[model samples]
Target chain A: MSTAGESGKGVGGLSTAKRRPGRRPGSADTRGEIIIAARKIFSEKGFDKATIRGIAREAGVDPALVHHYFDTKDGIFVAALQLPVEPAKVVPLILAGPREEVGERLVRFVLTMTADPEAREPVIALMRSAMTNEQVVVMIREFLTAAVLNRVVEALGIPPVNMEVAFAQVFGVILMRYVLRLEPLASIEVEELVQIVAPTIQRYLGGD
Target chain B: MSTAGESGKGVGGLSTAKRRPGRRPGSADTRGEIIIAARKIFSEKGFDKATIRGIAREAGVDPALVHHYFDTKDGIFVAALQLPVEPAKVVPLILAGPREEVGERLVRFVLTMTADPEAREPVIALMRSAMTNEQVVVMIREFLTAAVLNRVVEALGIPPVNMEVAFAQVFGVILMRYVLRLEPLASIEVEELVQIVAPTIQRYLGGD
Candidate 1:
């Protein structure tokens, strides 16, 4: 995070860097910088208290530029947490295949998405925030509901509660295996986990 | 927290409250007070940093008395987290039933324990700590391993990894239901949850 952007001040140094008419789209670097700053502030202060201006300050960018790019704090959050394979895009892929295999698809998706460090950033950030802050928990719930979970339940035609239980079961496994790095669960292979966990998820999705 | 006990001094008023030879077995209330203080300190400062003296001060009791009752910081932690239904006692009971039903028993036990506000306090406290502090996570994992999980795995004669996976799945559900309060999972009935989750646990425990 850049230390130069003064805190709580109106768009001071940012006016010069402001987007010009027909100027090439702002570099993705500024957006990336803002995300890094947002990740830090959100984790430290949580969703309820993390201010966009604070994030902009940490990023050494103008608050107006932040507003221009992300439009709102929630927009910045959603962008920061945008998983490499957007859940909205992938949940359908998992659901489209054989109905009975939805559990395997869903389990595999989580295990695979989290298998790599870079791929897991958005999830880790969101999960950490959710664990610490009630507001972030609600925000994450809304995000997951909109981006992936509710859609999966709708397509499966299962009770939303069952899907939630299934999701929580898998979510818990990820928390143990990755975040907490608990033994056995942490070291188990993804395929092995899929075999063990997929059936449970399957039951929640399809079982009576 | 006792307001009478001043903070950050070398055991000020505690000298008078120091245990005496015939001090009436250190009333259970004092022990209880110490546990309450310990819980708050441990949660706020985490396992590594929370000092015995700090807990004693918060309890408004002598530090020597704290040591006399709990022996060590770890002992205090164990006492603080000891649930109403000791896992040592309950795991055997769960295992004594038909082996096939062991999963159901275990799943029901967790859901029921967490369903009650007072009973769930220790688990919730440890879970919240585990989520935030790496040291606390290790401590909680070790505690679970010693108190209940390893014993359950041994009694079942299943691969320990499978047992861990089963536990993580259920643990995850609790996190979602109570900690994160995700929809459907949060609101689902314990019986309904058992019906949905028990089979998965059964599969992990006894299935191929």
Candidate 2:
């Protein structure tokens, strides 16, 4: 299936793309290098200023190859951040279920995504970075608003504040459970957390 | 009230205590120095291991003077972290009001505490440090449990999990408002925030 980061001719016709000497397109970790470059550029320039050409140049690959792997700047940003789940994908999934149950679905999705150690690290890393780096926070806010919050609001007919508060609660749980690791909260069963937290989130989302 | 950092004669007797050469105990910012030392020690050792004597020695001040200014290890810790309010002071206030209004009181307390930029910075800094530093996380977890969460639970007669969840929501609001500065949530009026969030917190705290 030619996994996300393995040797293969580029999907966007970068088969003959020139690169720095001694590295073939088919052998080296082209995708990985691109992500590394994207991460650095994003950190330095934030989500808005970082560009495909810049990341491609930093990675020593053709820009087309960058596009082949990650279709848009947001895609590259998602890859660079190593997000647990794509906001583009998850927003739809969250919205697909009955509107009243949006809280349950949203809570379940995040808890499930973060339950795995591998899936959770990047988010924690991004959040930690966001705490100190105003640039990262702005980038995340823009990306999240664009990719997730705006879509949900448009589809569900809620004010922006509702989503923000709902997110704040979920964000707090993730921080408490994973980062701060406050007891009982940290070790509590996922079902228990969802049960306790979901109704409030529902109220925030769908309330009068 | 003597400003917390200002020089004053020790409340505890340390009139003739010896210290490292070149700094006078009565004339200098002894309280501030002890807090600096306490911050360093707490960073190095989790809450249980840090001691008043260790912080005093690190500050090149007498332990009695440290005791004079801040009466207990927890007091020193609260000062070192530059927390906006004393959990000790705040907890009792949160409990003193009608039990149903506890959520509103809590929401108001945190919103008011973090309203000041100077006050919020330390908390954000502590949260940022906690994300990367295991020692800091452990220290915070222990201290918060001792000074705040446990006390709230004991007085409210709710399961500890209820307080944890309530705290999680408040914690999330703080991070969202001050750190991430997510819009609507960040800029919403305090009264509006209290209205929207207090009910949920009240539910969390006093709900069946």
Candidate 3:
């Protein structure tokens, strides 16, 4: 993966279409090829202008093969971004914790995901794409609202409305500190950032 | 101005050619026209896509007219947004009152600007545009950092680093209540909202 450079071809000795020999029998290499191509295409052209056919051409696969793997452009997008961790899985982690601990967990989860060198690029790409592309923005917002925010609200036994507010506060902090990289906040240690922000998020989530 | 609507011209009634009377002789109407055109263009296209030529076309003026009035696209944007009231105007207002009142004033200023029906559209547009547009985002971040956050920190006499965390809290509240319009926060009366939120803002700005 690191060997793949600006030309979209893998560096010395790596075959672009080579799949691991012992992988699941039915899974085609085309799907992985399409996703890699899509990531490069989406990053270069953004979500709106990048076409499915273009991705197929870049991947050296038929457009039908691309569709076979993913249901829609959005499906391809989700796959390409490699957002393998579903919000469903993570949202429950925050909710299962005590109400006071939920904020801490939420902050920690975001920080941990973004802090990883490998994970950071895709997340930043997703955010940048979301900012520019209305469809991507809507998709991301729906994912956040449903899989993350709604679950947290339900778990806390709070009204949906209040829960959304709390989610906004939590997400806003994550955006500011991680995505936007606003000064001092960006540079601060994770523990201090979580400590200062968690209490406010906790209050929004469950306080009077 | 009211009759202009009946005449079927879009906002501000003056024809694309006929200069409005109130504006100064040569430069003022051109400047106003450029700004009005710039706002529409920027809102429709976002910052990166919006061009001076597009603005001039929208204004039905020569491109040179735009350069003559504003020099650069950013200058035009700054003028169009009419964010002339910088932190200098705001910081003193927040600081001049009792320390306890700072939160109320901060909330009031943000809410008042956002709540104004006429102002809301452009302000929200600026925010949305800022999310994707690097130049515009930089300008906004700079203003938020230098003018807004810096003033609050100086007034409170806190270490500069702490201000970013404080700002994240304050901005999160505002973004939720105002921009995202999340539930209970959205429905709450301004006074009640202020009461609930001001303490938090106060704490972030100056409290322990």
Candidate 4:
């Protein structure tokens, strides 16, 4: 009899899949398992060395099963981070506020997301990976350019010529404080930091 | 009998003792050769994978010669980059100006250093290497803290508690614009960008 747990098994005997069969059993569950495994393996070994087979083994699925969920290693990586969070979810909220207030919202969102202990590790991992892994770096660069910075440019209605430089200024501030953990910026209260930084971001995003 | 370029041949030979004919015959020349080789190898293989033997081979000197010049891989790295220009050299210049003017000077220094096409590659390589190598990262963080931001804190006469956060904000802005290559920032004129960002950095560094 295939019990809820048994249904999770694959090429490996007695799969280590964390989900019970009670959860929907299609793409979603399989995808989730791959993500959890990838995150673990990527964190342990880093991007260059972590293999697909290792992720598959950890997830308790066949190598093919892992591929079925994610078409390639990069695909698995993007899925693992739950990244490329749709701008649609964030852009409207930022735009809904007054033009001057956009910087505050943007700063708050980034700080809140990165400040969470649970969320911090994945971001740090992704950044570390992006430095070493060419494909991942390209993907991250593209996503940052297209989804996050582009939307800010659009929302602010800045000239296309100015968009790139402005976004660089805003993103640079976040990267230094959040990823590099530079002093003063890292230790400051978020509200205080935001109050000081937001206006510059707003000016960059909105225009002179 | 010894000439500068001919002595370079000794630098290219793989045997350490053979390469050293006269008193300190090839020491300075050998060190220079090693640095050139190391820069090429490091740029190609990056910091993590580039080996001492590979650098020795490229320099045409024995591995011992490479070690003689630099005690460890990091010693070679720091020497190769010639990055001993710490905050002590740069920071006081930043603080020397009026408080309101400090941000512009700080941003100008970073942007100017990075914007130069010749200097840009090494800075980028340093950033990428620091992300992957913990030792290098710690060295960089400490240097930036002690030499740059801490001085700013002292100059401003703020409590030590406040220095870290202030540094974070200022460095954050610099990193985003320079390292990440964010839009508008990467594209914008340095002077324009400096004008816009300086006040905020000034505020974070010392402004009320």
How many angstroms is residue B79 displaced in model 2 relative to the true structure, after the best TM-score fit? 1.6
Among all candidates shown, the one with the greatest TM-score: 2
Give the per-residue lDDT of model 1 (tens digit) for B1-208.
1222232234332445644332233553677678888878876776667789999888887888888776667667767776446565577887887878878888998898789887777777666666677767765676566666789777777887788778887887887788778787888789888887888889888745
Question: Across residues A1-208, which tens digit of lDDT does each residue of candidate 1 receive?
Answer: 3233233234333444643333223444566677888877765666557788898788877776677666666667767777566565577788887888888988998898788888776676667766667767766676666666789778878888787778778877877787767678889889998998888888888654
Residue B16 lDDT in candidate 3? 59
Q: What lDDT tens digits, residue by residue, belong to model 4 across residues B1-208?
A: 1112232354445554434433233553677778898878766675666788999888877887677657567667666776533444466776786776766787788777767665666666667777776556655565456546568777788765345544444444445555554555557787877776566566556557
> What TM-scores do the predictions have?
0.70, 0.85, 0.62, 0.60
C-alpha lDDT (0 to 100) for residue A98 of candidate 2: 81
Q: Which candidate leads the pack in DockQ?
A: 2
Worst 10 residues of 4 chain A by lDDT: A1-10
Question: lDDT for each of the candidates?
Answer: 0.73, 0.79, 0.63, 0.62
Candidate 3 C-alpha lDDT tens digits along A43-106: 6675556778898778776566566566456667767777745565567766776766776787
Per-prediction interface RMSD?
1.7, 1.0, 3.4, 4.3
Relative to the unseen true structure, what is the C-alpha lDDT of residue A129 in candidate 3, on a scale of 0 to 100? Answer: 64
Task: Please list, in the order the candidates appear, how each scores on TM-score for chain B only.
Answer: 0.66, 0.84, 0.61, 0.58
Misplaced by over 4 Å in model 1 are A1-77, B1-77, B82-84
lDDT at residue A162 of model 1 (Cα atoms) = 80
DockQ for the candidate 2 complex? 0.70
**TM-score, ranked from best to worst:** 2, 1, 3, 4
Q: Which pairs clash in the backbone of model 1?
A: A172-B172
Worst 10 residues of 4 chain B by lDDT: B1-10
Ranking by lDDT: 2, 1, 3, 4
**Prediction-by-prediction clash tally:** 1, 0, 0, 18
Give the docking tier of candidate 4. incorrect
